[model samples]
Target: MTPTVIIQLFVFLLAGFVGFQTITRIPPLLHTPLMAATNAISGISLVASLVLAGSNQGLFSTILGTIAVGCATANVVGGFLITDRMLAMFKPAKLEAKESVA
Candidate 1:
């Protein structure tokens, strides 16, 4: 593999390890906030992916970018849904019931 690919792979592996450790060490109480922040970051990625998908790049790049867009969209939407549900758990029961009916 090229030097660039090797470096990228090393960085990716390091990030995976560090992210796993950091996330696992967080208290359960903090997961909601973490999800919210990641969702915002994923929204930024979605924008970047859209630019890639729309560009007059090569066929392979366009295909890869389109796939990235779909994955990013799912990640952003799913994270928000999970975060909202987690936040809802902290609300008063009365408010929760009222919103459920609306």
Candidate 2:
């Protein structure tokens, strides 16, 4: 393998390790914002799908791109639902006064 590929692989592994450790320590509330951002980015996959559809490749490329967008949509939705459930598990109950105000 080329030196550049080896360096890139090492960098990816190290980054993945650090990201895993960081995520493990994140508070439940942080999941809300993270999920929102992830969903936004995943939505961008639709544009990629459109671009792929307009390309000269055969039916296989179009099918793969469509599948990619569908999978991304599922991932974004599932991620948010999971994050919401996780946050619910950790959320503190509101005081009687605060509940009454709402």
Candidate 3:
């Protein structure tokens, strides 16, 4: 493989390892805040993918960017949804019911 490809592969593997380690080390109590942060990051990625998809670079790039946008959008939405659910778990039943009934 080309040097660039090899370097990229190495970086990808390293990032994956680091991300796994970092996530595993976080306390469960902190996950709700982290999920909000992750959702924000995913939202940023969705915006980036939208830009790429419309960049007019090439057919393949546009297609790949479109897929990325879809995946990132899903991630952002799902993350926020899960975060909201987790936050609700901490609310008193009265407050939860009031909000739900509104």
Candidate 4:
């Protein structure tokens, strides 16, 4: 295989490993707040992308910026919503246990 392809595969595997660890280790309470912060960062990326898109940039650069913005926005919004839902899952169980123990 080509060197570039090998590097890409390595990166892909590394990303998958880290992603798995993140999802497994992150607590529900922390997930919502972390996702909110990620959303803010992505919002900034989207604004920067818009500004770059208006410039006399190369086609490839513009396209890359657009894709980056789209991916970041999706991650931000979807991640936050998913995190909120995950947190909700813990709440009902905790509430029931609390009531039973009291």
For every model shown, what is its TM-score relative to the native structure? 0.88, 0.62, 0.86, 0.54
Error of 3 at 48 (Å): 0.9
In candidate 4, which residue pairs clash?
Answer: none
lDDT of 3 by residue, 1-102 (tens): 999999999999999999999999999999998998888889899999999999999999999999999999899889988998898889998997897899
Which model, 2 or 3, shows the larger TM-score? 3
C-alpha positional error of residue 88 in candidate 3 after TM-score superposition, expressed in Å: 0.7
The root-mean-square deviation over C-alpha atoms between each candidate and the true structure, in angstroms, is 1.6, 4.7, 1.7, 6.6
Under the 3 Å rule for N, CA and C atoms, how many clashes does model 2 have? 0
Compose the digit string of candidate 4's lDDT tens values, residues 1-102: 999999999999999999899888998558677777777877887788777766658898888777877876787788778777766677767686886899
Clashes of 3: 0
Tens digits of per-residue lDDT for model 2, 1-93: 999999999999999999899888989668777777776777787667767866859999988877876887787788778776766666566
The pairs that clash in candidate 3 are: none
TM-score of 3: 0.86
TM-score of model 2 relative to the true fold?
0.62
- 25: Cα error in model 3, Å: 1.2
Q: Model 4, residue 93: displacement in angstroms?
A: 16
Clash pairs (backbone) in predicted model 2 = none
